[model samples]
Target: MSARRLTLLVAGAFCLGACSSLNPFSSSNTKIPALKPLTAVAKTAEVWRGRVGSAGRFVFQPAVFGDAVFAAAADGTVVKLQAGRNVWKSSVDMPISGGVGSNGRLVVVGSPKGDVLALDAESGKMKWRVSVNAEILAAPVVSDGMVVVRSADSRLFGLDPADGKRRWVYQRALPALSLRSSAGVVQEGNAVFAGFPGGKLVAVNAINGSLMWEGAVAVPRGATELERIADITSLPVLGSRAACAVAYQGRIACFDLANGSTLWARDMSSSRGLDQDGRHVFVTDEKGSVHALDLSTGSSAWKQDQLAGRGAGRPRVVREYVVVGDVEGYIHVLRKDDGSLVGRLRAESSPILADIQLSGGDVVVQTQDGSVYALGVQ
Candidate 1:
């Protein structure tokens, strides 16, 4: 295999099914909840649709900046779209395992061959290519003039944006076993936040790649290694004062943005991520139930469990609603105040494995079958 496999996992990988659908607790409750009847309170429609190559065995989400959205697929296809039109398209000559990461100037993606490829965002030309020598499962983010790429071996490479030269490297200790995920590093201001295998969230200086502080989202404490698994499998969401993250078989916790102080934490398990609207933090638990928790106290404001076992992805807060996509390619728009389904639309027959991205007043999604749709709810 070109990609380095995780330790002690089945078939050389944990494979929560294809497209990261498997949870640690997937053994129980095998039934996918039947969606209750939804009386639409709002209208939802797909404004436009485009196409890219399939994501294959990995996740490929689009990167939105201004009017341009950059997307890629595992078949070496990288494309830039604007106004639902293809602006530029290029091939990387190699398959991409990770998704598109861009700053509107450079587009980046990770190959299964352990290489990071950067292309000019405007013209779709190759700018630079660098090697980390380990498999990169998550998207490489551009933060403060640095390209931050996380490899499967628990190493983060901070490279120069201009030439892909190594600036600094930060390494972490991986546990004996971990659930493989596409959780990438998120940049909030000058600090780059990342999650580790042991349910630890750390903030590092984006410039020098030095560790600033770390906090425990969930601790490893169980008799067996499977029971002790509590890795944060999603990107840490940032608010004005706090950074929040979720873990598989662990808890959802919010920490101080400046320091690693634990603000509040609640027992929750999810491989998908969360989003905050300054008032409430929105998340979908592992069972596909969406929730709204008080941002101040981590208390449950409301719970919408009608979609349990449907394999919902992260929560994206729009103006007055929370939107989430499920394995069946259904987009559910819920009332932010109350978790009632207000609108629904089916974008693809294939599953939506990528996190939702907001672009040009529409929720943009790249389905697992490589179809891109921009849907709007009103």
Candidate 2:
């Protein structure tokens, strides 16, 4: 899947931020409000830093397994960091983008010319690799001893985690832009729930790729400005009760986990990804606006344009703050309730917001330049 842009409302004069800037909350274009100096709720101190080959174009999101951080570089290298320390960095022949997964062992997906590799988590050694016909953009979801991955060809493949053997594969009717919607697999009892492009929500049997239920979701039809760069470029965020999905030019909707039915839908014409805090779902638009909505009702609780002037990043909830990276390589920490800027982590300059995760109370971030850094309180 391609990178998903944040949802923003661009009515104000400050909205001119570039799509490539690093700060998730950059005020480069718009005169930003005087932010109250951030109190030390969380102090970010750099733990360790490491570089990958040639400073590639994309940084695959990092996945944490126990005390180690697993990251895939643009040069098709997978590096392991143990507790903020570099363990090993292994290079493959092809460039890869998908995130990491594990069944009994660690598994990761590569590119159009790459294979799905199952490696030993403790040692960075490859166990087996399954060749695929398409590129893998989304992270492989692991469940029930199987590694589940969605390919650019609108196909879902299930492989044995132990040996990288094919368990089952399901092909769906995908639109031209369906390759951008990363497959999100959620296990509820015996059924596996995954989202698709061309506005589809499907439920498949976990044991086999048999279809359980399929339904069409509400796609966005808005102004031409919204449609130009609009598409569901992120994986569906699975909430406790519902699976939430945001589209660049489509509507944000929650589907029932039991059956592929729409529970609540919100029109986010320029939105991309959805992050939840158990009760509320957080999202952003292309114009640099962030919104908090009740997960159950899909009603807006709060909306803020603090990241005005430009918008791009996936908002990850860390503790009481919602952390999102911008086009300007800075990570903005916002209060979860009303969208107030709490703190900012100035990490990289040309940062691509891949995926951010917290392990052991420290923030682990992967940059587009194939660099990984760990930050935490002093």
Summed over model 2, clashes come to: 24
My TM-score estimates for the predictions, one after another, are: 0.94, 0.82
Residues 1-378 of candidate 2: C-alpha lDDT, one tens digit per residue:
322212223311112343322223334445434434667454566788766543343336777766677777666777787765777777666777676655335747566554777667667788778877776766777765567777756678888777878889998654322223333455666666666655556788877889987655555354544233334556567766677777655678787766768888866744346588788888876666778889989999888787764444667777777777765667777788878876777777765567676777777787776677877633
- Where model 1 places Cα greater than 4 Å from the true spot, the runs are 1-31
Q: Model 1 Cα displacement at 167 (Å)?
A: 0.6
Writing each residue's lDDT as its tens digit, candidate 1 over 1-378 gives 332243545423454543245542234445666777888997899888888878887887899899888889888999998867999999999989986899989999998879999999989999999999988889889854899998876678889999999998988887777777788899877688999889999998888899999999998879976778888888899999999998888999999998889999989988888999889999889878999999989999999987787888999998888999988889999999999988889877688878999975589999988888899877
Worst 10 residues of 2 by lDDT: 5-14
lDDT of 2 at 240: 63
CA lDDT for candidate 2? 0.65
